[model samples]
Target chain A: MPKAPAGTLYRGREGMWSWVAHRITGVLVFFFLFAHVLDTALIRVSPTSYDKVIGTYKNPIVNVMEVGLVAAVVYHALNGIRIMLIDFWEKGPRYQKQMLYVELALFVILVVPDAYFSLEHTVRTIFGST
Target chain B: MTATVDGAGRPVIEAPRSRAPRPGRARARSNFELYAWVFMRVSGLALIVLVFGHLFIMNVLDGGVQRINWGFVAGRYASPFWRLWDLTMLLLAELHGTNGLRTVINDYAERPQSRFWLKMMLYTSAFLVVTLGTLVIFTFDPNISG
Candidate 1:
Protein backbone atom coordinates (compact mmCIF):
# COMPACT_ATOMS: atom_id res chain seq x y z
CA MET A 1 0.00 0.00 0.00
CA PRO A 2 1.12 3.51 -0.79
CA LYS A 3 1.91 5.86 2.12
CA ALA A 4 -0.79 8.40 2.76
CA PRO A 5 -0.02 12.11 2.99
CA ALA A 6 0.02 13.87 6.34
CA GLY A 7 -2.33 16.56 7.74
CA THR A 8 -5.57 15.18 6.36
CA LEU A 9 -8.61 16.92 7.81
CA TYR A 10 -10.14 13.82 9.35
CA ARG A 11 -7.01 11.87 10.26
CA GLY A 12 -5.36 14.08 12.90
CA ARG A 13 -8.08 16.50 13.79
CA GLU A 14 -10.64 16.89 16.58
CA GLY A 15 -12.94 14.28 15.09
CA MET A 16 -10.33 11.53 15.05
CA TRP A 17 -8.88 12.41 18.44
CA SER A 18 -12.29 12.48 20.07
CA TRP A 19 -13.07 9.08 18.60
CA VAL A 20 -9.80 7.71 19.98
CA ALA A 21 -10.43 9.24 23.39
CA HIS A 22 -13.94 7.85 23.49
CA ARG A 23 -12.75 4.31 22.71
CA ILE A 24 -9.90 4.45 25.24
CA THR A 25 -12.07 5.82 28.05
CA GLY A 26 -14.81 3.34 27.22
CA VAL A 27 -12.50 0.32 27.52
CA LEU A 28 -11.06 1.63 30.78
CA VAL A 29 -14.50 2.11 32.29
CA PHE A 30 -15.65 -1.35 31.09
CA PHE A 31 -12.72 -3.15 32.71
CA PHE A 32 -13.20 -1.17 35.88
CA LEU A 33 -16.87 -2.16 35.96
CA PHE A 34 -15.88 -5.82 35.79
CA ALA A 35 -13.67 -5.48 38.83
CA HIS A 36 -16.15 -3.23 40.62
CA VAL A 37 -18.98 -5.71 40.32
CA LEU A 38 -16.74 -8.49 41.60
CA ASP A 39 -15.65 -6.45 44.57
CA THR A 40 -19.21 -5.50 45.42
CA ALA A 41 -20.06 -9.19 45.16
CA LEU A 42 -17.81 -9.81 48.13
CA ILE A 43 -20.62 -8.45 50.26
CA ARG A 44 -22.48 -11.70 49.63
CA VAL A 45 -19.56 -13.71 51.00
CA SER A 46 -19.41 -11.87 54.31
CA PRO A 47 -19.57 -8.31 55.52
CA THR A 48 -16.13 -8.70 57.00
CA SER A 49 -14.68 -9.70 53.66
CA TYR A 50 -16.54 -6.93 51.91
CA ASP A 51 -15.40 -4.24 54.32
CA LYS A 52 -11.85 -5.52 54.24
CA VAL A 53 -11.78 -5.25 50.46
CA ILE A 54 -13.60 -1.95 50.30
CA GLY A 55 -11.34 -0.44 52.93
CA THR A 56 -8.48 -0.70 50.50
CA TYR A 57 -10.36 1.70 48.23
CA LYS A 58 -10.08 4.38 50.92
CA ASN A 59 -6.34 4.73 50.75
CA PRO A 60 -4.70 7.71 49.05
CA ILE A 61 -3.44 5.88 45.96
CA VAL A 62 -6.73 4.20 45.17
CA ASN A 63 -8.55 7.42 46.00
CA VAL A 64 -6.66 9.13 43.22
CA MET A 65 -7.46 6.24 40.93
CA GLU A 66 -11.12 6.66 41.74
CA VAL A 67 -10.89 10.22 40.57
CA GLY A 68 -9.34 8.99 37.36
CA LEU A 69 -12.09 6.42 36.92
CA VAL A 70 -14.73 9.07 37.37
CA ALA A 71 -12.99 11.23 34.82
CA ALA A 72 -12.97 8.38 32.34
CA VAL A 73 -16.67 7.72 32.87
CA VAL A 74 -17.50 11.39 32.52
CA TYR A 75 -15.62 11.73 29.25
CA HIS A 76 -17.11 8.57 27.80
CA ALA A 77 -20.62 9.61 28.78
CA LEU A 78 -20.34 13.07 27.27
CA ASN A 79 -18.76 11.85 24.04
CA GLY A 80 -21.30 9.13 23.69
CA ILE A 81 -23.95 11.83 23.53
CA ARG A 82 -21.93 13.59 20.89
CA ILE A 83 -21.82 10.40 18.89
CA MET A 84 -25.57 9.96 19.13
CA LEU A 85 -26.17 13.46 17.90
CA ILE A 86 -23.83 12.91 14.98
CA ASP A 87 -25.85 9.87 14.06
CA PHE A 88 -29.43 10.98 14.74
CA TRP A 89 -29.51 14.69 14.17
CA GLU A 90 -29.65 15.93 10.57
CA LYS A 91 -27.08 18.70 11.06
CA GLY A 92 -24.99 16.84 13.59
CA PRO A 93 -22.43 15.69 11.08
CA ARG A 94 -21.91 19.22 9.88
CA TYR A 95 -21.35 20.55 13.40
CA GLN A 96 -19.46 17.62 14.94
CA LYS A 97 -16.40 19.72 15.62
CA GLN A 98 -18.47 22.30 17.45
CA MET A 99 -20.19 19.51 19.35
CA LEU A 100 -16.80 18.16 20.43
CA TYR A 101 -15.88 21.56 21.86
CA VAL A 102 -19.16 21.62 23.73
CA GLU A 103 -18.51 18.11 24.99
CA LEU A 104 -15.04 19.02 26.29
CA ALA A 105 -16.32 22.19 27.97
CA LEU A 106 -19.05 20.17 29.66
CA PHE A 107 -16.52 17.50 30.64
CA VAL A 108 -14.31 20.00 32.49
CA ILE A 109 -17.31 21.69 34.03
CA LEU A 110 -18.58 18.40 35.43
CA VAL A 111 -15.33 16.58 36.28
CA VAL A 112 -13.60 19.40 38.20
CA PRO A 113 -16.26 19.59 40.87
CA ASP A 114 -16.47 15.79 40.96
CA ALA A 115 -12.72 15.46 41.45
CA TYR A 116 -12.76 18.04 44.24
CA PHE A 117 -15.55 16.28 46.07
CA SER A 118 -14.08 12.85 45.47
CA LEU A 119 -10.63 13.76 46.69
CA GLU A 120 -11.50 16.08 49.53
CA HIS A 121 -11.17 13.39 52.19
CA THR A 122 -8.02 12.00 50.69
CA VAL A 123 -6.51 15.46 50.51
CA ARG A 124 -7.40 16.06 54.11
CA THR A 125 -5.91 12.74 55.05
CA ILE A 126 -2.64 13.45 53.30
CA PHE A 127 -2.24 17.05 54.43
CA GLY A 128 -3.66 18.61 57.55
CA SER A 129 -6.53 21.02 57.11
CA THR A 130 -5.75 24.73 57.32
CA MET B 1 -29.52 3.90 -18.59
CA THR B 2 -29.24 0.22 -17.78
CA ALA B 3 -26.16 -0.21 -19.92
CA THR B 4 -23.40 2.06 -21.14
CA VAL B 5 -20.38 1.51 -23.35
CA ASP B 6 -17.00 1.74 -21.73
CA GLY B 7 -13.82 3.04 -23.31
CA ALA B 8 -12.94 -0.52 -24.30
CA GLY B 9 -16.27 -0.86 -26.15
CA ARG B 10 -17.56 -3.27 -23.50
CA PRO B 11 -20.99 -2.70 -21.97
CA VAL B 12 -21.30 -1.90 -18.29
CA ILE B 13 -24.44 -3.10 -16.61
CA GLU B 14 -25.97 -1.23 -13.72
CA ALA B 15 -27.44 -2.94 -10.65
CA PRO B 16 -31.19 -2.75 -10.12
CA ARG B 17 -32.24 0.61 -8.67
CA SER B 18 -34.60 -0.97 -6.15
CA ARG B 19 -32.72 -3.86 -4.60
CA ALA B 20 -35.58 -4.80 -2.29
CA PRO B 21 -36.58 -8.41 -2.55
CA ARG B 22 -39.80 -9.21 -4.38
CA PRO B 23 -42.85 -10.35 -2.49
CA GLY B 24 -42.67 -14.04 -1.47
CA ARG B 25 -38.91 -13.91 -1.78
CA ALA B 26 -36.97 -15.31 1.12
CA ARG B 27 -35.14 -12.55 2.96
CA ALA B 28 -31.78 -13.81 4.10
CA ARG B 29 -30.70 -10.66 5.90
CA SER B 30 -32.20 -9.30 9.07
CA ASN B 31 -31.92 -5.88 10.74
CA PHE B 32 -29.76 -7.18 13.57
CA GLU B 33 -26.97 -4.71 12.96
CA LEU B 34 -29.39 -1.83 12.66
CA TYR B 35 -30.97 -2.77 15.95
CA ALA B 36 -27.58 -3.05 17.57
CA TRP B 37 -26.74 0.44 16.37
CA VAL B 38 -29.93 1.84 17.87
CA PHE B 39 -29.44 -0.14 21.06
CA MET B 40 -26.10 1.53 21.65
CA ARG B 41 -27.64 4.98 21.57
CA VAL B 42 -30.66 4.15 23.70
CA SER B 43 -28.70 2.21 26.31
CA GLY B 44 -26.04 4.91 26.36
CA LEU B 45 -28.62 7.55 27.30
CA ALA B 46 -29.86 5.35 30.13
CA LEU B 47 -26.37 4.62 31.36
CA ILE B 48 -25.50 8.32 31.51
CA VAL B 49 -28.15 8.65 34.19
CA LEU B 50 -27.54 5.33 35.96
CA VAL B 51 -23.75 5.46 35.96
CA PHE B 52 -23.43 9.13 36.88
CA GLY B 53 -25.88 8.68 39.72
CA HIS B 54 -23.84 5.75 40.94
CA LEU B 55 -20.60 7.70 40.66
CA PHE B 56 -22.05 10.69 42.46
CA ILE B 57 -23.31 8.58 45.36
CA MET B 58 -20.35 6.25 45.69
CA ASN B 59 -17.41 8.51 44.82
CA VAL B 60 -18.46 12.13 45.37
CA LEU B 61 -21.08 12.40 48.06
CA ASP B 62 -20.78 12.46 51.88
CA GLY B 63 -17.05 11.87 52.26
CA GLY B 64 -17.10 9.70 49.15
CA VAL B 65 -15.39 6.32 49.20
CA GLN B 66 -14.07 6.87 52.68
CA ARG B 67 -17.50 6.28 54.17
CA ILE B 68 -18.41 3.25 52.08
CA ASN B 69 -18.40 -0.04 53.94
CA TRP B 70 -20.49 -3.14 54.54
CA GLY B 71 -22.84 -1.13 56.72
CA PHE B 72 -23.21 1.43 54.02
CA VAL B 73 -23.89 -1.38 51.57
CA ALA B 74 -26.50 -2.88 53.88
CA GLY B 75 -28.17 0.45 54.46
CA ARG B 76 -28.49 1.11 50.75
CA TYR B 77 -29.70 -2.39 50.01
CA ALA B 78 -32.33 -2.13 52.75
CA SER B 79 -34.44 0.03 50.48
CA PRO B 80 -36.19 -1.56 47.50
CA PHE B 81 -35.72 1.58 45.43
CA TRP B 82 -31.94 1.53 45.74
CA ARG B 83 -31.86 -2.17 45.09
CA LEU B 84 -33.82 -1.81 41.86
CA TRP B 85 -31.73 1.14 40.84
CA ASP B 86 -28.54 -0.84 41.36
CA LEU B 87 -29.94 -3.87 39.58
CA THR B 88 -30.99 -1.87 36.54
CA MET B 89 -27.66 -0.09 36.43
CA LEU B 90 -25.73 -3.32 36.71
CA LEU B 91 -27.59 -5.03 33.85
CA LEU B 92 -27.56 -2.05 31.51
CA ALA B 93 -23.91 -1.20 32.11
CA GLU B 94 -22.77 -4.75 31.58
CA LEU B 95 -24.71 -5.18 28.33
CA HIS B 96 -23.58 -1.81 27.03
CA GLY B 97 -19.96 -2.58 27.80
CA THR B 98 -20.24 -5.99 26.22
CA ASN B 99 -21.62 -4.62 22.97
CA GLY B 100 -18.99 -1.91 22.90
CA LEU B 101 -16.20 -4.44 23.35
CA ARG B 102 -17.70 -6.64 20.66
CA THR B 103 -17.40 -3.76 18.24
CA VAL B 104 -13.80 -3.11 19.30
CA ILE B 105 -12.90 -6.74 18.87
CA ASN B 106 -14.47 -6.89 15.43
CA ASP B 107 -12.47 -3.83 14.45
CA TYR B 108 -9.03 -4.80 15.73
CA ALA B 109 -8.84 -8.58 15.79
CA GLU B 110 -8.01 -9.27 12.18
CA ARG B 111 -7.37 -12.97 12.48
CA PRO B 112 -10.60 -14.96 12.37
CA GLN B 113 -9.48 -17.43 15.01
CA SER B 114 -8.28 -14.66 17.30
CA ARG B 115 -11.48 -12.72 16.81
CA PHE B 116 -13.58 -15.78 17.57
CA TRP B 117 -11.68 -16.56 20.75
CA LEU B 118 -11.67 -12.94 21.90
CA LYS B 119 -15.40 -12.62 21.48
CA MET B 120 -15.92 -15.97 23.21
CA MET B 121 -13.93 -14.75 26.19
CA LEU B 122 -15.77 -11.44 26.19
CA TYR B 123 -19.15 -13.15 26.17
CA THR B 124 -18.13 -15.54 28.94
CA SER B 125 -16.94 -12.74 31.18
CA ALA B 126 -20.12 -10.80 30.54
CA PHE B 127 -22.24 -13.82 31.38
CA LEU B 128 -20.34 -14.46 34.60
CA VAL B 129 -20.58 -10.85 35.71
CA VAL B 130 -24.28 -10.55 35.01
CA THR B 131 -25.11 -13.81 36.76
CA LEU B 132 -22.88 -13.20 39.76
CA GLY B 133 -24.06 -9.63 40.17
CA THR B 134 -27.74 -10.51 39.94
CA LEU B 135 -27.35 -13.31 42.45
CA VAL B 136 -25.45 -11.11 44.87
CA ILE B 137 -28.07 -8.38 44.63
CA PHE B 138 -30.98 -10.68 45.32
CA THR B 139 -29.37 -13.09 47.79
CA PHE B 140 -27.63 -10.55 49.98
CA ASP B 141 -28.41 -11.26 53.64
CA PRO B 142 -27.80 -8.11 55.59
CA ASN B 143 -28.32 -9.83 58.95
CA ILE B 144 -25.70 -12.49 58.50
CA SER B 145 -23.15 -12.88 61.32
CA GLY B 146 -19.65 -14.14 60.70
Candidate 2:
Protein backbone atom coordinates (compact mmCIF):
# COMPACT_ATOMS: atom_id res chain seq x y z
CA MET A 1 0.00 0.00 0.00
CA PRO A 2 3.01 2.30 0.55
CA LYS A 3 5.13 3.78 -2.24
CA ALA A 4 8.38 4.51 -0.37
CA PRO A 5 10.93 2.33 1.38
CA ALA A 6 10.23 0.87 4.83
CA GLY A 7 12.34 3.45 6.68
CA THR A 8 10.68 6.24 4.71
CA LEU A 9 7.64 7.80 6.30
CA TYR A 10 6.48 9.69 9.37
CA ARG A 11 8.36 7.03 11.24
CA GLY A 12 11.90 7.54 9.85
CA ARG A 13 12.29 11.09 8.76
CA GLU A 14 13.84 14.40 9.85
CA GLY A 15 12.78 14.08 13.47
CA MET A 16 14.37 10.69 13.87
CA TRP A 17 17.74 11.82 12.47
CA SER A 18 17.81 14.78 14.79
CA TRP A 19 17.22 12.55 17.74
CA VAL A 20 20.09 10.37 16.61
CA ALA A 21 22.44 13.33 16.23
CA HIS A 22 21.76 14.72 19.71
CA ARG A 23 22.72 11.45 21.33
CA ILE A 24 25.77 11.12 19.12
CA THR A 25 27.08 14.57 20.01
CA GLY A 26 26.52 13.94 23.69
CA VAL A 27 28.58 10.80 23.51
CA LEU A 28 31.26 12.69 21.61
CA VAL A 29 31.53 15.53 24.11
CA PHE A 30 31.71 13.01 26.92
CA PHE A 31 34.57 11.14 25.29
CA PHE A 32 36.48 14.31 24.49
CA LEU A 33 36.16 15.44 28.05
CA PHE A 34 37.41 12.09 29.23
CA ALA A 35 40.44 12.26 27.00
CA HIS A 36 40.96 15.85 27.99
CA VAL A 37 40.97 15.02 31.66
CA LEU A 38 43.41 12.20 31.12
CA ASP A 39 45.63 14.26 28.88
CA THR A 40 45.76 17.05 31.44
CA ALA A 41 46.76 14.48 34.00
CA LEU A 42 50.00 14.14 32.06
CA ILE A 43 51.47 17.01 34.07
CA ARG A 44 52.40 14.70 36.93
CA VAL A 45 53.99 12.15 34.64
CA SER A 46 56.63 14.56 33.43
CA PRO A 47 56.92 18.07 32.13
CA THR A 48 57.95 16.70 28.74
CA SER A 49 54.77 14.65 28.53
CA TYR A 50 52.80 17.66 29.51
CA ASP A 51 54.50 19.69 26.84
CA LYS A 52 53.83 17.03 24.27
CA VAL A 53 50.18 17.06 25.19
CA ILE A 54 50.14 20.79 24.92
CA GLY A 55 51.93 20.59 21.65
CA THR A 56 49.32 18.30 20.18
CA TYR A 57 46.74 20.96 20.86
CA LYS A 58 48.74 23.27 18.64
CA ASN A 59 48.17 21.38 15.41
CA PRO A 60 46.11 23.33 12.89
CA ILE A 61 44.02 20.29 12.17
CA VAL A 62 43.49 19.74 15.84
CA ASN A 63 42.56 23.40 16.12
CA VAL A 64 39.82 22.76 13.57
CA MET A 65 38.76 19.68 15.48
CA GLU A 66 38.49 21.68 18.67
CA VAL A 67 36.04 23.87 16.85
CA GLY A 68 33.92 20.84 16.10
CA LEU A 69 34.06 19.89 19.76
CA VAL A 70 32.98 23.39 20.73
CA ALA A 71 30.06 23.18 18.30
CA ALA A 72 28.99 19.87 19.77
CA VAL A 73 29.16 21.23 23.28
CA VAL A 74 27.30 24.38 22.32
CA TYR A 75 24.53 22.66 20.38
CA HIS A 76 24.12 19.89 22.90
CA ALA A 77 24.16 22.30 25.79
CA LEU A 78 21.59 24.61 24.20
CA ASN A 79 19.22 21.85 23.09
CA GLY A 80 19.76 20.19 26.42
CA ILE A 81 18.67 23.29 28.25
CA ARG A 82 15.61 23.35 26.02
CA ILE A 83 14.91 19.82 27.08
CA MET A 84 15.17 20.79 30.74
CA LEU A 85 12.69 23.59 30.20
CA ILE A 86 10.22 21.10 28.80
CA ASP A 87 10.67 18.54 31.54
CA PHE A 88 10.75 20.87 34.51
CA TRP A 89 8.50 23.67 33.30
CA GLU A 90 6.08 21.57 31.29
CA LYS A 91 6.73 23.59 28.17
CA GLY A 92 4.37 22.64 25.35
CA PRO A 93 5.59 20.25 22.70
CA ARG A 94 3.83 22.36 20.10
CA TYR A 95 6.74 24.79 20.17
CA GLN A 96 9.39 22.11 19.80
CA LYS A 97 10.34 23.16 16.27
CA GLN A 98 10.57 26.83 17.10
CA MET A 99 12.64 26.12 20.15
CA LEU A 100 14.89 23.90 18.08
CA TYR A 101 15.49 26.68 15.56
CA VAL A 102 16.23 29.20 18.26
CA GLU A 103 18.58 26.76 19.92
CA LEU A 104 20.46 26.35 16.61
CA ALA A 105 20.68 30.09 15.96
CA LEU A 106 22.12 30.50 19.41
CA PHE A 107 24.46 27.61 18.70
CA VAL A 108 26.03 29.34 15.69
CA ILE A 109 26.21 32.64 17.53
CA LEU A 110 27.90 31.04 20.50
CA VAL A 111 30.25 28.70 18.61
CA VAL A 112 31.85 31.12 16.15
CA PRO A 113 33.39 33.22 18.88
CA ASP A 114 34.35 30.23 20.96
CA ALA A 115 36.07 28.58 18.03
CA TYR A 116 37.72 31.81 16.99
CA PHE A 117 39.20 32.36 20.40
CA SER A 118 40.43 28.80 20.56
CA LEU A 119 42.02 29.00 17.12
CA GLU A 120 43.59 32.32 17.97
CA HIS A 121 45.02 30.85 21.13
CA THR A 122 46.25 27.76 19.34
CA VAL A 123 47.94 29.81 16.66
CA ARG A 124 49.61 31.87 19.32
CA THR A 125 50.68 28.82 21.23
CA ILE A 126 52.16 27.26 18.13
CA PHE A 127 53.86 30.26 16.51
CA GLY A 128 54.73 32.05 19.73
CA SER A 129 52.94 35.08 21.18
CA THR A 130 51.92 37.79 18.75
CA MET B 1 -15.32 10.44 26.11
CA THR B 2 -18.71 10.83 24.41
CA ALA B 3 -20.74 8.38 22.39
CA THR B 4 -23.64 8.63 19.94
CA VAL B 5 -26.70 6.54 19.02
CA ASP B 6 -28.38 6.21 15.61
CA GLY B 7 -32.12 6.37 15.03
CA ALA B 8 -32.03 2.59 14.68
CA GLY B 9 -30.50 2.78 18.19
CA ARG B 10 -27.17 1.04 17.68
CA PRO B 11 -24.65 2.68 20.02
CA VAL B 12 -21.62 4.05 18.25
CA ILE B 13 -18.38 3.18 20.08
CA GLU B 14 -15.05 5.03 20.22
CA ALA B 15 -11.51 4.21 21.41
CA PRO B 16 -10.46 1.05 19.67
CA ARG B 17 -9.38 -2.07 21.49
CA SER B 18 -5.67 -1.07 21.43
CA ARG B 19 -6.42 2.41 22.75
CA ALA B 20 -5.30 3.53 19.30
CA PRO B 21 -7.44 4.37 16.29
CA ARG B 22 -7.11 1.36 13.98
CA PRO B 23 -4.46 -0.89 12.45
CA GLY B 24 -1.82 0.75 10.18
CA ARG B 25 -3.33 4.17 10.69
CA ALA B 26 -3.59 4.62 14.44
CA ARG B 27 -3.95 8.27 15.46
CA ALA B 28 -2.57 7.50 18.87
CA ARG B 29 0.47 9.51 19.96
CA SER B 30 1.91 10.36 16.55
CA ASN B 31 4.35 7.75 15.23
CA PHE B 32 6.93 5.30 16.55
CA GLU B 33 6.50 6.29 20.18
CA LEU B 34 7.12 2.73 21.24
CA TYR B 35 10.46 2.77 19.42
CA ALA B 36 11.43 6.07 20.94
CA TRP B 37 10.72 4.76 24.39
CA VAL B 38 12.93 1.78 23.75
CA PHE B 39 15.67 3.97 22.26
CA MET B 40 15.80 6.13 25.34
CA ARG B 41 16.25 3.19 27.62
CA VAL B 42 18.82 1.42 25.48
CA SER B 43 20.85 4.53 24.67
CA GLY B 44 20.74 5.66 28.30
CA LEU B 45 22.23 2.39 29.48
CA ALA B 46 24.91 2.42 26.81
CA LEU B 47 25.74 6.03 27.67
CA ILE B 48 26.25 5.16 31.34
CA VAL B 49 28.86 2.61 30.42
CA LEU B 50 30.54 4.49 27.54
CA VAL B 51 30.60 7.79 29.39
CA PHE B 52 31.80 6.40 32.70
CA GLY B 53 34.35 4.08 31.16
CA HIS B 54 35.79 7.03 29.28
CA LEU B 55 35.98 9.10 32.44
CA PHE B 56 37.69 6.36 34.39
CA ILE B 57 40.23 5.81 31.66
CA MET B 58 41.02 9.45 31.23
CA ASN B 59 40.76 11.26 34.56
CA VAL B 60 41.04 8.45 37.07
CA LEU B 61 43.70 6.24 35.57
CA ASP B 62 47.42 6.67 34.84
CA GLY B 63 49.00 10.00 35.83
CA GLY B 64 45.61 11.67 35.62
CA VAL B 65 45.10 14.76 33.49
CA GLN B 66 48.81 15.46 33.05
CA ARG B 67 50.44 12.80 30.96
CA ILE B 68 48.70 13.32 27.61
CA ASN B 69 50.80 14.79 24.82
CA TRP B 70 51.41 15.01 21.08
CA GLY B 71 53.59 11.93 20.87
CA PHE B 72 51.08 10.04 22.96
CA VAL B 73 48.26 10.77 20.53
CA ALA B 74 50.53 10.12 17.61
CA GLY B 75 51.47 6.85 19.23
CA ARG B 76 47.84 5.91 19.70
CA TYR B 77 46.93 6.75 16.17
CA ALA B 78 49.91 4.80 15.00
CA SER B 79 48.08 1.60 15.68
CA PRO B 80 44.92 0.63 13.85
CA PHE B 81 43.70 -0.59 17.20
CA TRP B 82 43.52 2.84 18.78
CA ARG B 83 42.03 4.27 15.61
CA LEU B 84 39.19 1.79 15.71
CA TRP B 85 38.72 2.35 19.43
CA ASP B 86 38.55 6.09 18.90
CA LEU B 87 36.23 5.84 15.91
CA THR B 88 33.85 3.61 17.78
CA MET B 89 33.83 5.97 20.71
CA LEU B 90 33.14 8.90 18.42
CA LEU B 91 30.15 7.27 16.76
CA LEU B 92 28.56 5.82 19.88
CA ALA B 93 28.96 8.90 22.07
CA GLU B 94 27.45 11.23 19.50
CA LEU B 95 24.48 8.94 18.95
CA HIS B 96 23.89 8.62 22.68
CA GLY B 97 23.83 12.35 23.42
CA THR B 98 21.73 13.15 20.37
CA ASN B 99 19.15 10.54 21.31
CA GLY B 100 18.94 11.84 24.86
CA LEU B 101 18.33 15.33 23.57
CA ARG B 102 15.65 14.12 21.13
CA THR B 103 13.63 12.79 24.03
CA VAL B 104 13.89 16.19 25.59
CA ILE B 105 12.66 17.89 22.43
CA ASN B 106 9.52 15.76 22.24
CA ASP B 107 8.60 16.42 25.85
CA TYR B 108 8.75 20.23 25.60
CA ALA B 109 7.85 22.91 23.00
CA GLU B 110 4.07 23.26 23.06
CA ARG B 111 3.47 24.58 19.56
CA PRO B 112 3.69 22.19 16.65
CA GLN B 113 5.56 24.66 14.47
CA SER B 114 7.88 25.53 17.31
CA ARG B 115 8.63 21.88 17.89
CA PHE B 116 9.24 21.33 14.20
CA TRP B 117 11.62 24.25 13.79
CA LEU B 118 13.42 23.61 17.05
CA LYS B 119 14.08 20.06 16.03
CA MET B 120 15.12 21.25 12.60
CA MET B 121 17.80 23.45 14.09
CA LEU B 122 18.80 20.72 16.50
CA TYR B 123 19.19 18.23 13.67
CA THR B 124 21.13 20.61 11.45
CA SER B 125 23.59 21.44 14.18
CA ALA B 126 23.92 17.80 15.14
CA PHE B 127 24.69 16.77 11.57
CA LEU B 128 27.35 19.44 11.22
CA VAL B 129 29.00 18.48 14.46
CA VAL B 130 29.07 14.79 13.69
CA THR B 131 30.35 15.31 10.14
CA LEU B 132 33.09 17.70 11.20
CA GLY B 133 34.05 15.66 14.23
CA THR B 134 34.49 12.52 12.20
CA LEU B 135 36.59 14.34 9.66
CA VAL B 136 38.90 15.77 12.27
CA ILE B 137 39.43 12.52 14.11
CA PHE B 138 40.16 10.53 11.00
CA THR B 139 42.33 13.09 9.27
CA PHE B 140 44.16 14.46 12.30
CA ASP B 141 47.53 15.97 11.58
CA PRO B 142 50.22 15.90 14.20
CA ASN B 143 52.58 18.36 12.58
CA ILE B 144 51.32 21.45 10.84
CA SER B 145 54.16 23.96 10.62
CA GLY B 146 56.84 21.34 10.43
Per-model CA lDDT versus the true structure: 0.90, 0.60
Provide C-alpha RMSD values for all models, in order. Answer: 7.4, 14.2
Model 2: per-residue Cα lDDT over B1-146, one tens digit each: 65567679888776566653567765546657667656555555554455445534532345322344556656666777766666665566556555555666666576778778877876765675566656656665555322
TM-score of each: 0.86, 0.43
Which ten contiguous residues of candidate 2 chain A have the minimum total lDDT?
A: A1-10
Summed over model 1, clashes come to 0
Q: lDDT score, residue B123, model 2?
A: 72
Minimal lDDT window, size 10, model 1 chain B: B20-29
Pairs of residues clashing in candidate 1: none
Question: What docking grade does candidate 2 earn?
Answer: incorrect
lDDT of 1 by residue, A17-49 (tens): 999998899999999999999999999989889
Off by over 4 Å in 1: A1-10, B1-27
Chain A TM-score across all models, in listed order: 0.90, 0.78
Clashes of each: 0, 51
Best by DockQ: 1
